[model samples]
Target: MKTADPALQAMLRERNLRIIMPIASILAALGLWEFLVWYNDVPHYLIPAPSLIAKTLIQDWATLAQSAWFTVKLTLLSLSLAIAGGVLLGMLFALSRTVEISLFPFAVILQVTPVVAIAPLILIYVESTFWALLICAWIVAFFPILSNTAIGLRSADHNLRDMFRLYQATPWQRLRYLLIPSALPYFMAALKIAGGLALIGAVVAEFVAGTAGQNTGLASRILESSFRNEIPRMFAALFLVSVLGIIIFLTTSWLSRAVLGHWHESEIKREL
Candidate 1:
């Protein structure tokens, strides 16, 4: 690779410097937070100090870690199912206008219905808590993937479609060679949006279902912490939730770039 020009290097360094300053500012704010709490002699139960929050994070690390892991599992598993089912259904819709017209209304209904409302019904009908939670999360996360993938599948260039038709490309060949690549950017976009939604869904579902022993997740930990008035522990769980969200966002971004950076406008990197 060509070395960056010195002026460009300096500009890049300055840009990164701009990013670093905000992080420093946040840390400074936290330090100020610790000081103010001390200065006011604030009760820990009311608003825990940063130091106490850190300490509680360490003290209750084991249970918090397990709960975080459970939440992660539900998010991952539900996201996987969402992508699989949505993409398959989207492909069916894409290939046949008849199917799209017939089934799209149902898809819209499912997508529109609030998962909070659905969770209770799912809990009653689904014997296992795990399955119910999965269903709820999947319901919330699947729509974006389905809608975006369907659009992507139909978004192939008209010339390319004509070429495929002229070549008598089989359905599988069209899918493998043309449709999937065309849909990738859309899928990635949907994944980024749905990644956060999946997390929200999992947590919301857990909150509604009360996280029975087998279904324990971060929502349970957060609720339990709040009920017990363990402010620091609540903050710690919240910190973990924020970290999980950041990880998911970053992971999906990286995956989008890796998959579509070479071609798609959505994921392409621009020259400075």
Candidate 2:
């Protein structure tokens, strides 16, 4: 049999380690935490063991699942809105200097202002709690996309731009062929950032809205558990939120790789 190439074997080992290391670390940490808690006879109410949190998650799955679904819906809806608004506004800004100058400060203001500070005011104004939460999440997720897209659109090579102009390319052709491609990498990066922000905003908005009932999200569950001093349940809800965020991140990363892996340096895999 032919010997395996050493470089390929090294690459495979590296890839395996990348996957193994994080999982090993997480398991080790949890084991240590469980041991210390059991050894010290720690109260579950103060810091429940990971196993107890997992048990709470299973026992409360029905209630927790519904709330998780609500949170997922809220996060996705707000992110969708943010993408639509941010892309359109970014394009307009890239195409018009006056528009950028006029509107960018307002975007900055929205980003700098804490969502919690304005969430109460938004709830007071918006008749529907869902809409209010959505607006808050949108505000949190919109700025990064807008800024990145605008910058990316403007980042196309001037030489390529001049060539397009020399060829008398139509506006649509220039946009479709040149501007969009240049902006895609930046936009993908922003998507990862905005995805997490959207979830955080939804949770924070729900915390402020404090809407209770069948339609409420994970944040409401966390708040209720906190109020009742059901620490394990609170931890369970938090664990779900963390998992949801990780899912969003992984999905966005996969999408970025799918879209850019063949051409973009950022996504292309290279042997170490």
Please give each candidate's TM-score.
0.93, 0.96
| Candidate 1 off by > 4 Å | 1-4, 11-15
* Native-to-model Cα distance after best TM-score fit, residue 23 in candidate 1, in Å: 2.3
Candidate 1 backbone clash number: 0
Which TM-score value belongs to model 1?
0.93
Number of the top candidate by lDDT?
A: 2
lDDT of 1: 0.92
